[model samples]
Target: MTLHTLNLTPHGLGERVMPLAPTLTLRNGQRWVAQHYLRYQHTVESVSALLAQIDFDAHTPLFAGQDEQGVYVQVGLIGRENYDRSNTLRVHKLVYGRKWRIDADTPTSEIIQTAFLAIKKAREHEVRELLTVRSRDGKTSAAFSNHHDLPLLAQQRDQLQAGNHRVATLDVAAAVQHQLASLRFAQRAIELVQVLELSAGRVLIDVQLGAAPLARQLEGDFPEFEQLALCVLLPAARLHELPYALMDALIEHSDRHVDETFRFRGFARFSRSNQIQAIADLSLQTRPYAHDLADVQFEQIFRANNYEVDASRAPALGEGELGRKNRQLINQYENLLGHLPRGYEQTHETKMA
Candidate 1:
């Protein structure tokens, strides 16, 4: 049976009807069916049954909500085996919902700069420790902070002198350390700045180092060492790669299974339809659905319409890195959808018409 004739409530299908007043007529004279946001409830068996009947295409927008037992019914867009109990399906679509304004007292840009400088200082301290050595007699000691200090320690055989094997070792080690520190600093700075922009500056680093020495310096309090280490070691690429891989998976899966009648085309196809709906929705309303629904309000709307929006899974803008990444991934996915072709026949027909 067609979707319109299906027993929506009995079969556990819930949908938000698009207002008829706002419809699009393409230049080809074909009326575009405004995309519908469907939320499906009930057990996996019933949902699977519903999936088997409907002929989903690149223009279909469907979302499966968590049931009363908190088990999410798998939407056939992704492989059934890959589907998890968690809400990974909706993450690439939902918005942050709240304003992420920057704080006037402590901007994230300044904090990141301070942390970067501290890491540099710590590296210098480590190099200094490595260069310092004591004589075998235990009567004298030589210390060198940089290459300029080499001359001062030249007379002492135990010290790192010009052309000394120890000096060469120190130079090589220092250069390698400097290069690594510089690369890490640049990567961390970019990722943190992106997070700030994505969150509208609402999220800030919890701790700031200012001019204080890092723990490795061993001179002053090291309260900021953890944050500094996190800045230096955290993998910025991981934050971006996860979502990129997910998008690639969706595309690859769609291309491989495009002709499979029993399986639903992957998220890339659903994304295309959702994007069209978003365009039409924006044309009719002042704000998009994300900004229109607050966290609690989103849950309420979902419940009122016979769907469930898991509060725990709903990402918050101010929650820091994960939240920022989620927003970024959503934008990237939507952009991908925009450039994608609808279908072979549909695209050709539109161009001919």
Candidate 2:
């Protein structure tokens, strides 16, 4: 459906907007997918201007919203959920006629670095798979160790899958090697800037980064609240000092090296309350594997930060300032957990028992 033909309802303060579902095609024949739901606050005029700037043939408008500030329009690239920051800034500038900037900060840096690492690791894995192969005679030979053998072996594997094992191996190794070389060169030239720009844009949308108002607003509607367990809560002031690299490593390890032990989901920043805080959502499982992995990750974080890991180091009531803070955190955790759905309490109790 086209933006002009979209069924938009009057939102807050008489603004018109509507939510778009994933995989829905727009007038220009592009599908939309959102990594997470987002709301944008914009005005009617601004929305119209933004629509005019959009090349429907190239971009996809995911959804729209309105608020006290203005009308917010969520837009994405043709086939990606997460797009480059330049695209978002272009939309903002088109609507408001001013440049929008995202400050380079630690959180932004970490997010970009994490994304780059994930992409590089994936590519290296593909290369490894291509390197590990056997010949048609089911034997390893130095003759098959040439660069051409990689794609030839890959094609042979495809032929085997198609039940055509008798197909003769052709001398197309040089072409495949050339293609691989070109791909490698292009990846080296563009992947850095591309990943950084894409991840920088993501910072404005990521709920964990606490940069997007719409993302924060939608946090209240997160469906996994019942399944989430608060693993750690640190003062907002300590955000810069926290072991983010360790956290990223643990997440990568869980995702790549191990099975589904546990996932370090993301962070939730609470700044509206009396005391600003950052909560790490390490929704741990009851399984032994989960416990072991959690223990190791936490221990590394604590040690790297020079925090005590022993139970005895935990402050006693009225003994030390650290004790007071620890008690307050325990109370906060309990309060949050208690307010969850009824079944959650039972499951948590059973797990503890």
Candidate 3:
């Protein structure tokens, strides 16, 4: 059915949340899938079959949530289900539910207003999917990929049968936001970490120089950067600037290179391993929250953070005594430069007098 509007309710939330973080769980999940059983019958059958057959190895997780367009996918519910932050979305303040009570015939105006308000107040948002895949036996539902092409409910003819022949569905929540996802940028920074001398067998420079942004040095004109992990998290607005950063790096030294192992996708956690390299993991998280940060310094945290909260105080640059002093210094520097001889160079400080 075409969506006329959308609504959210917290009815029956308190009780259902105790056992697990409320999702389209195995319990009563069939009820929703039954609603669309006929149209997505084959798709349901396929998913159910896979869910039935997966061999849970020693390391395989008991649960999995994936994002698929047009499918009701679950956000990440990763790790030991304590539900503090490890399994939370990192972009928007996600509103969750024990059950998604779809309000049919909701006023278009209300839907529009909800969306409008989210858009007006939001700094950034994205569309994500949430589907449930449980590991229990004799169950049906296998839609686990971030990509799928299942039939919509309107196309089905058969009715949902709960037992024996069962199917589950994906939950498409609005990835809209009520606040902005903000990151604080450091000014006049230097790259603190580098492993070029130890890796790629490159010679180190004798004179110590400040660190560099490998992207800037390379100027984004390389063959292998398409797979570079940092680019995955690079903001879309700066995509054009990627090439320049890469170009700069490439021109400096052909042999000197970057460490490609650690790429930026989302929040990462590292623990000690017997091997030299620490084992790093990116947790499956959902629904980024903004409550952790001061409203002025930051807006929204876009990635699932396992890191501790520590906000650095940014120096106020204007409208204060310190600001006035800074401005006065800059003005003096400019005036001094203007009075000096043009194109004059003090090569080895030949003569100041």
lDDT of each: 0.30, 0.28, 0.23
Compose the digit string of candidate 2's lDDT tens values, residues 1-353.
43322223234322222233223343346433221112223344434333343232222232334555443434332221111212232222111111122111112222223323333343233222222222456543222122356677777886634321221123122322222222211011101111111221111101121122333223322122222221222232222212232233223432332122111222112113323222221211112333333555543543433222122233334435654454445544534521232223322332131
Candidate 3 RMSD to the correct structure: 31.2
What candidate 1 gets wrong by more than 4 Å, as runs, is 1-3, 10-40, 54-353
Q: What tens-digit string does per-residue lDDT give for candidate 1 at 1-353?
A: 12333322333433233222122444445443333223333344444343444344432223323444442322222111111122223222211111121111222222222222332333333323222223445432213333345455566756532231222322432432332222211012111211211232121111112232232233221222323421221122222122222223323433333323222323332243357776665556433346334456554654454322333233344345655554445544422422222122122222221
Clashes of each: 0, 9, 41
Q: Which window of ten consecutive residues has the lowest lDDT sum in model 1?
A: 185-194
Candidate 3, 214-250: lDDT as tens digits:
5323322222322322211112223222223332332
Tell me the TM-score of each prediction against the true structure: 0.20, 0.16, 0.15
Which candidate, 2 or 3, has the higher TM-score?
2
Best by lDDT: 1
Best by TM-score: 1
| Model 3 per-residue lDDT at 339 | 23
The total number of steric clashes, by the backbone 3 Å criterion, in model 1 comes to 0
Ranking by lDDT: 1, 2, 3
